[model samples]
Target chain A: MLNYLWGAMIFIGILVAAFTGNMAEVTNGAVNSAKEAVTVCITMLGVMSMWTGIMKIGEEAGIIRSMSKGLRPLLKWLFPSVPEDHRAMDHIATNVIANFLGLGWAATPAGLMAMEELQSLNKHKERASNAMCMFMIFNMSSLQLVSINIIAYRTQYGSANPSEIIGPGIITTLVSTAAAIAFAKAAEAAS
Target chain B: MRAISVLSDLILPLVIVYILSCGYSKKINVYEVFIEGAKEGFKIVMDILPTLIGLMMAVGILRSGGTLELISRAVSPIVRRIGFPPEAVPISLMRLVSSSASTGILLDIFKNYGPDSFIGRFVSVMMSCTETVFYTMSVYFMSVKVTKTRYTLAGALAANVAGIAASLTLCQYLWG
Candidate 1:
């Protein structure tokens, strides 16, 4: 991690020198890029707020609870160590649900709380348990439903159809999540 | 030309050649295909609503609870010394909360200060490659009830370092 940090610093330093040599263009492009990013971010906030509202409605309508019910079986398979009545299951459901909708912002705390709960169950204090490994793997490669940020970026970059990455995003996530899961399970077996 | 461009961009010409060899029908409607593709995106958003909300509320609670400050303080000095700005600290913390939100905020940062600024480059690169690993792992682990691992923090932080490196190098090379 420290190595990467140093590399980034060195890289940025060179970029600074290069841009300074051509002050006119670099400054202009940087300004334009920043401007575009702000516009896109503003638009994204609107989208995020709208989704957040809709999700609230879903919760009020019992939609989320029902969805979690459906996910329970799969959760059981993935986390057999957890007792049937554990709160961790609920947290997992919520976490997966958030990822499914590309509402990653919403999922952070639930992820943490879930980890705390899971930690309570751990017998070992120094090493990560198998379940911990599995959980990390899944989270790392969690499938995204919206990929909204990328779309916004594409728009910022002047792509004709900024949302066009959705198909590829879905495909890539599916592949990555499956790979992450496979590796995690394999590790569990070896351990 | 439009149809050719869409088909060429999305699928390999060899596949098109195979379809043609197989006596496939004449030209397809590019607009229709595009719409169909976009509709799939809408469906995905619809399908994930509950999870998104629960996750958000949980994060909202954590934020309200002031956990981000604690996490930020621990990582601040290292990030700052690397030429990343102090303001970027919260955004990076938010990233552990959510990527889209983080990106949205990054845009705000970029607006206030150009992307070429020391901070802007670091944040942008951080945005490009890093996943919200800590938040995701925290939730997943908590849900399953298997805790007590230190490697997760290490691995995730390491990944962020790599992402920062990649972003900085690429942006400087391409935009700088």
Candidate 2:
């Protein structure tokens, strides 16, 4: 009852916004928001580019592969469905690493690429595979260790110690990932 | 000085160019496109300005009508019992509602109190970890046509619980 109620609340909220001449406003907001989003995207570009360059450097330096190799055991545990040597696992590893640094913008493309590779491995069309479910769960939980966007916002708003959130970010993500993984496995088991 | 001035002008708008390039190819003249896009952008701003005002008013009502205050008050005891300072309650609640806006508010708190301040650090941790569960669930479920699911609600709420707990623990230990 409560589930349906909350769903209705959201549906109705979007509906009401659409009906009450707020559609124009909503559309406008979406566009304006898009513009602002563009600005933000731009702002993040250099940051992402820097990180991507660094990641590339790391890759060339064999650091990323080593990190992925080291993370293999844990990644295998977290994603039991993916073959350890699968290309999807590598993309997932890169995606997870990028996300941990709070590089959401960077992580997104990597995540999509990971999903595409994962999909290639999927034989079922109607029902999601275990890998798909785990991917979605992990993406939603998004184990952010640095929370770069928040730090950027802090800097934008004149924060004196914008980088201070890193510790908490790391801790919270570790906890959230553990919980998410546990719940996801439980759901898989129940199903 | 001339080179410095030229370089400075180039620096700020770099973000502008990079953003436009993301959705489109590099071959296009980004500056011209951005300029052309600004009119539509301005129109969008004008259109949404009223709604933005309304949203702000709604937020203002929550703030001034004392509902927000009451919520913080109600949650304070529970949070305090877990070792978080009372100041974290409001910010945590707000973060659940909207991350971008909460980021602004969190920045203000960080600025005023210093990031190492107990409450500031707690809020920081909270900001880093949590998603806007209510908003995301609402949007995702609606889009996906999921009209029934008690477990989904429970699941989302559970994620929030884990987030908050981790936030408290980390802030108290490492940042404490």
Candidate 3:
């Protein structure tokens, strides 16, 4: 799926640029954007390391376990395919907590771990399970308690009230999370 | 709202204190554990670097080639009816595809219209509220080596659209 999307994007970009005589801009964009990607990751490295370290402390101290215990009921409801004692639940909880804090870079490792654990439980090796789909939906639409990245951008841009959008951000994400859960449930039912 | 804001502000400090105290009570080597996790974090960054570069380059090419503008113009009428500014069409379109690219678009919007401006605030909310659906799905699925992602993309994209709608609507009610 992503393979097709990537191919189409590059193909259409070059074709359109050629027709519009914007090939120079395309060339520049490719180089600059690739550099931008590295720069973005470098910026993310600090935050990711900090949060993941703290989360590691949390994990070693059993905070993550307690947190996962707190979320057990709801998570169980969300992912029926995953068992109660499964390691995937812990990973899922960690991912959800990281996402809620708006630590997306920190969340990816846990999210990947969750997917890998869930995959281990799958009978069909090639196909994604319902639990996997639900987990993806929740991770993708995870409600953020603090949008640190956007706030950082706002402050950098010199906004007088950098946090003003926090209210709308929370509300909008809550709505989207509800929608994601509902869509996942519907999709699961259909499948 | 004020209480929530305060709590949000305190979350970092609270988490840090809680973790430190918990580690202390457990007599765990917090520093060593933290360094280990940090190393893993760097490894995670290295793992995703290629995907990030590919996604960014693709999105950048599309944007620079004027494909996004063309698509934005085509979608303007419907977007206008939903009360979103035409300028935000690109951000919304790119939000699901690549987060860094969307941030770049957001910075452009902020520069053009001050961050305090309605469009700027709207785009900020939109960007904060939504996830990079395709990028996330690809990375996650790739990690698990799941070639047949059944309904994950559809579900995520649906959620993204919902987020975009809610962002536009809430921004209008709160800040418009």
Candidate of highest TM-score = 3
Error of 1 at A13 (Å): 3.3
Please provide, for model 3 over A1-191, each residue's C-alpha lDDT reduced to its tens digit, 9 standing for 90 to 100.
55776778889988888888899899988888788667766755765667668767777787755666778888999999888889998899988976775556657798889999999999998999999989998888856766666665576567897777776777788888999999999999988
Please give the CA lDDT of all the candidate structures.
Answer: 0.53, 0.56, 0.79
lDDT for each residue of candidate 2 in B1-176, tens digit (9 for 90 to 100):
24423432453245344444442442545445444444443443344344333333333333333434455677887876767676566567666666544543464455446665677667767777777666654543343333443344455556667988877876666646
The digit string of per-residue lDDT tens for model 2 on A149-172 reads 555545544556655565456657
TM-scores vs. true structure, each candidate = 0.53, 0.57, 0.73
Candidate 2 segments whose C-alpha is farther than 4 A from its true place: A1-70, A84-87, A116-127, A152-162, B1-67, B77-87, B93-98, B111-116, B132-160, B174-176
Q: What is the lDDT of residue A115 in candidate 3?
A: 91
Candidate of highest lDDT:
3
Regions of candidate 1 where Cα sits further than 4 Å from its true position: A1-11, A14-20, A23-30, B1-130, B134-176
Q: What share of the reference contacts is kept in model 3?
A: 0.74
Instruction: Please state the error at residue B33 of candidate 2 in Å.
Output: 24
Native contacts retained, all candidates in order: 0.08, 0.15, 0.74
Among the numbered candidates, top DockQ falls to: 3
Q: Any idea what lDDT model 2 has? A: 0.56
